[model samples]
Target: MDISTLLAQASSKWPQAAALSEPARDRHLTFRQLDQALTAFGQALERLDVGEGERVALLADAGIDYLIADYGCMANGRVRVPLDPTLSPVELLAQLRDAGAALLLFSPQYADVAEGLRGEGIRCRALEELTVAADVDLPDRPAQPPQSLASLNYTGGTTGVPKAVMHRHASLCAVLQNIVMARGAVLGDVLLNVRPLWPIAAVAVLAHLLSGGQVVLGGRFDSKTFIDQLAQQRVAFSSLVPTQLLRLLRETGSAPADLPLFKSLDIGAAALTGEVLDGAFSLFDGRIAVLYGMTEAPWSCYLAAAQMKALRQSGESAEGVVGRSLFAAALRIDRADANGIGEILLAGPQLMAGYWQQPGLTGEVLVDGWLRSGDLGRLRADGQLEVLGRCKDIIRSGGKSVQPGEVEQALLSHAAVREAYVFGLADVEWGEQVCAAVVLEGGASASVELLVEHCRELLSRYKVPRRLWFIEELPRSHYGKVQKKRLLEVLGVVAS
Candidate 1:
């Protein structure tokens, strides 16, 4: 069934269960209350003359209002186009124009931007205004077909122009199923979601609710309070990007022993180096897991907590291990080098319908029913998937190809290197030379010479970074994936 049906089913099955919560605002909604709110917002959309299947763009922070707009748009057969608040108005406008949004709904914080969009001839409305109770009932609309559009999620635009990944009701339902199976969310499971609700993390929020579980929106993540919330809410499941996991480790020392209620923590959005994984495992008592996928097909692979413990006990490096494909997804390698690594290919019901309004671009990735995932990976004999870096991120140094992830992992193995990003810089002699931008642990320093020498011991000659820059933090997208293509511009380094 579709997302709307799924939420309705949850409401019917557990009318009194806590469906959503915002601890910061002391706001909470039970299943029946959430369903009513969704219905009210749907009626509001109808009153605004937004026809069925028309796009409604949501640009607001994660909270009760954003939640209503998101579910209401979908439940009422309207396509939800989520705009990243972190993006500039130019970028946001580009997506809005691309999606052909019938209306733009935003919170009070975005009033200035909404006014600017209105000046540009786009219809804008305050999200809270629409949340007011509608006295009249909205006529029941026919259920959309499973293939009907559900949302337009734009890419992170880390590399270049952002393309909206078109997700259908069927594909998103598949994602919900995969998440439930992979994360094992029980009826009473409590999931603390601090990640931005506009991205893939929002799916996790839906997955939990659809499974009759409670979701606590833990506003902006403050490591200190994050721990307190876990203990207070008895949160059993949570997800984090690698960046967030790293910060939690540094700021909170280790997962406090008092947090016995906390259970699963899945890390995704970027690869996890062995160093960070080990530290997180220690901090969270092996509750950490690895989730791998893209905007095109989220929840593709999952490295569960038990498997992570086994991998660690086996003394194998967990650096690139992103676990096995989910039950509904199939994965393969397209072309391979001598080392058996190649671009990862994914085929599944959860795959995005295509890039919205860009059939030609969609043709590039969706070929023969399998998504050309652009990510490089190799499969272990035991069926686990180990993702290398992106194929676009490979460094051609002196006629030899080097994967940046391998070098970055080696750099992270060093005591001082807290975070490392490896990329290629144009060089006349080597064609392209490996370069690095690193963030050291607090109060820790390492010479570029020392880091280079350390890499030489772990990587081949061509793979070691010839040049390195120490920075306070790596540039990242709102979703926490490193923006590799922007490192040079962000670091103010020019290619030789």
Candidate 2:
């Protein structure tokens, strides 16, 4: 189904139902209202002459406008490239310099951030000043053909340059299909977007909206606002990364006694620890589904909710499994020599079309109709997918190999530790040594000695951290992923 079809269907079938909300601004949308906004937006884009295949960059926080600009581009089939609202000027410029978008639809709140990138020579706008024609005649902007370019997903720069992965319209539809199948989400299912509007997670939220369920739009996941929305919006389902889920559980605890409205939570994007998952289950049992996904394909693989509860009831470690593959995506563990580890290969329509303008790189990963997920994972005998760690992120300590996720999971299990990251540091003697950085919970102190002893009970001697550094907070991206390399540098274990 094309984006135009999704919008048109929603407008026709659910004209009076709320389509979006900006509770903070006291602004909301019914289906008819959303339709008006899209028509006005399409007309406005026509005013700027945004034709097919043109790139439209949306630089804004998650709100009504962000979805508006995003859907507007989708409706007209303009490739939508979302910039993190929290990006620095340099960060924004790298994107601007790369894509050279024809039109930039930005919000006033982030207006200054956009202006800072003016040297890159791209047109930018505050959504308020942009309007449709007075007697707006909606120009019919067709959705891009299946083979046409649809999105440009930029990965964090490794060689000091961010690379955008491009996908065809068909591949984007595959992504939506995988998401719907993965979430078990179907018609009449409402989803919440309390996270950023970028990334693969956006695919799920958008599909829910397009499939006739309402999208409860909001900005950053403010604890109070989130709990209130979950209660008032009658939210059936939503998605989160582990970090966001941690904070949401804390907020949901303060939810009123009468509230039991939330049905399910789709969580992924970080290593799942026993403490975190158990804490999530304790807070919202039978409702949390930790997912294993990649931006390239199967945005979610194997949902570990009901399975986790069963495992817990049976006195087993439910946290060990990341669940089975979504309906469309599949996983297999072929590299046993790496200790039951294999490079995950995602094959399905859900895979991306290719990396934008980087055909060589795309060919390297998308081989034989499978997207080689750089993550190293294995499948349990019962068909559960267990992610060991990222291929590059796993630290090699004197050739024994140390999966930071294992050490971090053990560290998080400590009552005093709040957050942790495990990395290998250069060592003159042992080649590379395992170093861990941690944040103590509630500012409580814990000695590395205690932590090491705690880990020795659970992990092998070499798998434990040789050195530890305590920090107040881990450096995270806007999406709440710990930047390990950055952390190692900040702790003086590695050169910046």
Candidate 3:
């Protein structure tokens, strides 16, 4: 089913229910009002000569306007390409060119950037300027097949250049159905969303809408503000990456008593160290789930709070437990070694059709019916999955493959360490040496010798980091994944 159909269903069933709201602006839309706005905006797009299946680029921050435009595009059968406003003009232009976007719709905040892109001969229009009369009749909704293209989602370009992952209406619907069924989401549920809407996290918005739940949109994440809003709105569900969770824990210092209304905090987009996980469970009196998926295929594996607690209490390592596969997906390890470490492979309806306009690159990853996830992981005897690290992130030290996640988790276990990132640096004799960057906890102190001694107790000699550097914070992508390439640049070393 198309997203538009889902929205229409929600609107009809609960016309008076709150559909979307921006608490910062004190603006909200009832289900009926949101549907009307989508229809009007869609009609406006038709008047602008935006043909069906044409690419329409949206460059705006997360707000009411972005949501309306997104839904409007869906209603009109336009392929929406949401761009990260945080990217440079050069980066944004590359996406615009890659998608062959015919028109750019942006918020007032990005007016200057829109003009700059327009100066490069791209057609641009401010979203505020695209208004239609309230009584204007919307054109007939196009009859789009389930397999029709819906959105072009671009990668965060953390490891390399960004590539567009093509998603169809059916794939997204399957993902939404799986989530709604798994979470038991209902009309009264409220999701507090603080991440930018351009990324796959926007799927949360769609999921809430599909389940007839309310969405509370916030601009950027401020730990104090987020917690305050969560309490004020009595939000039931939310998601965060590891970096954001760490910051929230540090800022709050202790859990507030008023956040009991919050039901679940779905953590994903990066790995959560054991220290962070422990702190999260202690601070939040709700489900703390670790979600494992990529832009290519969401809803692959979900480690729920019960499973997390069980693993902790049973003394099983929580370092890489991403739980079991979703009901709608199947997972396997390809070419597993003696330890069961291998590249993860997934097959399901939620998989992306292919990388946009990159047939060669698409063929490399998507083979037959499975997506080669390029992530190194192992399946436990209990059927749980442990994502070790990325295949490309393995460090070969003295002919031994060292998983960065294991070493980083050990460093994080140190009382003085708040965050740690491990990478490989070139060495003449060893070929590559394990190196680490660590962020110390507030007012905590530790020497390199002390940290090395600590690692020696837990890790093998070769698995321990050979070099370590203390830093204020590790570099992270917009989605909060550690940018190893940027770390190498920060350390004044080029990757070999």
Candidate 4:
């Protein structure tokens, strides 16, 4: 299953069942129509001589055309690198230059950014012009093996560099299998792929299309409509980050009309709080779940709704568990701190073949066929796993250690607190200070003293927020993960 097979399969099954659509644009392509669009884009890329294995950059808004260019690259054996278009030209150029990409494909809206890179000896083209009518003499490209390199998705590493996580066709196929097995996804499920496609889990949405399901395509995400879409499209499956889920649950109506048609809700891309997990589970009647994976390992653990419900019924909270392994993937909690909380290491076919062009870095983490996940966690005797926090996010203040996630959990449990992020800031006395920034629910405001007092009852005094600030909204990436690094910058908080 080269990723292209998904689109090919869909076009074969229900060519007229609306394969892709963006309601705002009044633009849609049936499976047959989608095939033509992909052919046109492939032919267009062929004319440009975008060779096999060459890195082609796609910086554009999410839509049907972007999907065309992505699979079109797969169809032509070219490795596609999808980037968030929100990046500044400087940051964008820095990555392109490092990738050694010969050709850049982007929408006309980003034409200025693409044009700016031309002076740097980088060939760039407007993605709008990347496609042409069927008459063009596009070169013939042969099919590629499933193990051929699929794409290099960039993610920030502990070293602070934008490391490319290499993924292959086989890895993606395993991911598809894991998704099908973990989610029980089926052909008739309506999927709204509203999250950015840069993250690896997003490939699962593409997998749904490949597995012959209805795909409601576009990057447009509106909470009101998102909640409405569940009933409107009768959407059975959907994926979103905690932030998007937060907004969706906060819709104006106490109980939105379409709140109940979902068969599955898979959330990832960031740590989901107990607040969000409880809210989502209760809202969907426990059809919601949290998927744990990274760019390097696409589908790893799955925490299903049943597990969460059981935990709650047993007087326990599904507080921090990311879930169990999916699709034969194995997980072992070998790291411990006298409490059995250690790093989670995994081994599976779904793991990335290696970091693209970063073998030294790959070797450092992938030891003996296992991925040494940098996350710190513990496995309960019953086998449910609880992720405490990333190794880097655990804060040490004075002599005691603090997991920022714990503080955040306490803050969000408050009815007035809509969202919270905790991190260590510089302090002359304690060596490091615990700080928090919260967004109140529904524009409601809370006194800083009152907020701190509430944390005193829910959290340890040391873990209580020393600094608290209210913001209209928290800064987030397109995929809805908080840009904690950026948030710290805005707060003028510096790590010691």
lDDT order of candidates, best first? 1, 3, 4, 2
Off by over 4 Å in 4: 5-17, 32-40, 132-141, 157-161, 253-256, 259-261, 305-316, 411-417, 426-431, 438-473
Per-residue C-alpha lDDT of model 1 across residues 97-211, encoded as one tens digit per residue = 8889999999989999999989988899999998864455444434668989998898847235668999989999899899989888789889988888876667778898888
Tell me the number of clashing residue pairs for each predicted model: 0, 2, 0, 3
- Report RMSD (Å) for each prediction in the order shown: 2.1, 2.9, 2.1, 3.4
Q: Of 2 and 4, which scores higher on TM-score?
A: 2
Instruction: Quantify all predictions' global Cα lDDT against the true fold.
Output: 0.84, 0.72, 0.83, 0.76
Q: List the residue pairs that clash in candidate 2.
A: 166-356, 302-324
Across residues 1-496, which tens digit of lDDT does each residue of candidate 4 receive?
7666655666768777766767667777677676667767766776888777888888887777778777777766788788767777777777777677868888877888878888878898877786543454333345569989888787772224557777888787788888877777676667887876764545776667766677776456788677766677778788887777877777743342455557777887256766666677777777767788777787788877677667778987676777778877888876588989888888898898887678899998899999988888888888867777788777778878898878987888788998888888778788788888999987576899999999999987899988898887788865566788778778776655
lDDT of 4: 0.76
- Model 3's alpha-carbon lDDT is 0.83
Q: Clashing pairs in model 1? A: none
Better of 2 and 3 by TM-score: 3
Q: Which stretches of candidate 2 lie over 4 Å from their true place?
A: 130-143, 157-159, 185-189, 250-258, 412-414, 453-459
> Which candidate leads in lDDT?
1
Winner on lDDT between 1 and 4 is 1
Q: What is the lDDT of residue 438 in candidate 4?
A: 94
Between candidates 1 and 2, the one scoring higher on TM-score is 1
Residue 13 Cα positional deviation in candidate 2, in Å, after optimal superposition: 3.5
